[model samples]
Target: MRSKFQQRRLFEQTLNKIIGCNLKALPTTCLIAADDFNDEASFKRLVADLLAYDCRYFMTYGLVAEVLHDKIDEVISDLELGSKGILTAAHSDEPIDEIAWFFVNATAPEEDCVQYFFGFDDKAAFNELSRAVKKEVQKLNAKFND
Candidate 1:
């Protein structure tokens, strides 16, 4: 398993890549804190500084998951209703109070977009998230190459 420092470094690298490749998209990246941690404050600041965007703190991972999984229209409606960091439960009867996942959405003005959802509880989750980010980068690069 990678150390916390290693994980943070990898996450930063991924974010940098997204920023470099999608600068014109005016991408708004969000770091979702699913659970409390010792270094959450520092991490939150890091994400905000790197993306120059806001970090959303959700009370439960279930609510964040629901927001992530919901259709764009639903999400927009929620946002329109002034639900920025405040997420209302739309699913999950019993919300688990565990370190769930981190959510990142790299959206372009056009139809091309990428959304990453991966847990930080284990190394596998981090690796999966890394792969997903790389795939998105590749797709974006391909569009420019062509």
Candidate 2:
């Protein structure tokens, strides 16, 4: 078994690899999607593997409008970090079509945040949504930099 330090190093390497892949392919955001993997299990395995590292995972459901409008604080507060299963159970009555996964680097600055967007109908939709998300993020950054 690897020591905690070794495990963390490995996680960082994997995270960097994912980020690099996204940068080369998409060039806008580091948001991985289910379609990015060979199979659903592979995508899910990545999520599970990342859970062992020093990160906080959260999922947001149907909050694109809020994000676009810059009500991100409300969306963040509504997320139950590390409790996607619980949130799904609580909202079982609704049909969950998409889930946006946030892997926040607990030990690093917030700018190192990684995201995975899942459950879009196709690649076109995913690309469109990612572009919108990237635009909103840029807006937020500009607001803070001002």
Candidate 3:
């Protein structure tokens, strides 16, 4: 009977581990430098990085984010926060091929899992997708809790 947040968190964690299967030992917090960072969003995104991407990384510059402008502040804000790598990104030096391969290979199963829970969508569709998924997970969690 996991709570909704716990279930979503677990799903996100599971996805990161599965995606990082190719790495020898996975990365850690030393990759980032809050003291060096100056933006607020970068700070939040730094924390989000840990949650989203896990500790697994081939990064050293804390993560050279190529984030959209709106997301920029959040990334700056995440400067010192932590979690899995689901919210993380790669540094400039990291091989984009490796990341591309990671994303391509990791897509099917994780997509299936998400599709099972809440269906599919691209970025423009995510607003609806997010709402549906949250509501669904909440309903299921309520049932299990009952």
Candidate 4:
């Protein structure tokens, strides 16, 4: 399997195009896997930051997954939603909270197994993530570029 660096480099090569795909709002696996394939560390951090939507409850109060989805996905959603310090592009006019929710609550990318492979851990990469996300928003859409 390609290392995290390999994956990140590949993604960086086309990061703008992929982010512009709006696939997170769609179901295209091509954008998901191709862009998300990162080294173990990078993948783990990205997934962790994306969050599972409900793991905070478990982490904070020791709540069991039984009452919830009882699945690990819920945990991932929580982390994604909880992390701070990620950047938001100006074009992503949506508030940071809303964006985080999107990453956390949105349906999973079918090719997201890479996240599980290293036990996605967002905290490890929140700083870098925020910067990346913030930059994306400010980038003028190609159609509107000078």
TM-score of each: 0.32, 0.33, 0.23, 0.19
Model 2 residue runs over 4 Å out of place are 1-40, 60-123, 142-146
A best-first ranking of the candidates according to their lDDT comes to 1, 3, 2, 4
Task: Give per-residue CA lDDT, model 1, range 35-81, as digits (tens).
Answer: 22344344334333433332222222333444432432243353463
Instruction: Write candidate 2's Cα lDDT for 118-137 as tens digits.
Output: 23224453454444443443
Task: List ranges where model 1 is wrong by over 4 Å.
Answer: 1-26, 30-36, 51-106, 111-125, 142-146
TM-score of the candidate numbered 2? 0.33
The reply for model 4, stretches above 4 Å from the true place, is 1-31, 35-38, 52-146
Model 1 compared with the native: what TM-score?
0.32
- State how far residue 85 of model 2 sits from its true place (Å): 11
Q: Candidate 4 lDDT (Cα, whole model)? A: 0.26
Candidate 1 weakest lDDT stretch, 10 residues: 3-12
Model 1 residue 65 lDDT score = 41
Better of 1 and 4 by lDDT: 1
- The local lDDT score (0 to 100) that residue 19 gets in candidate 3 is 36
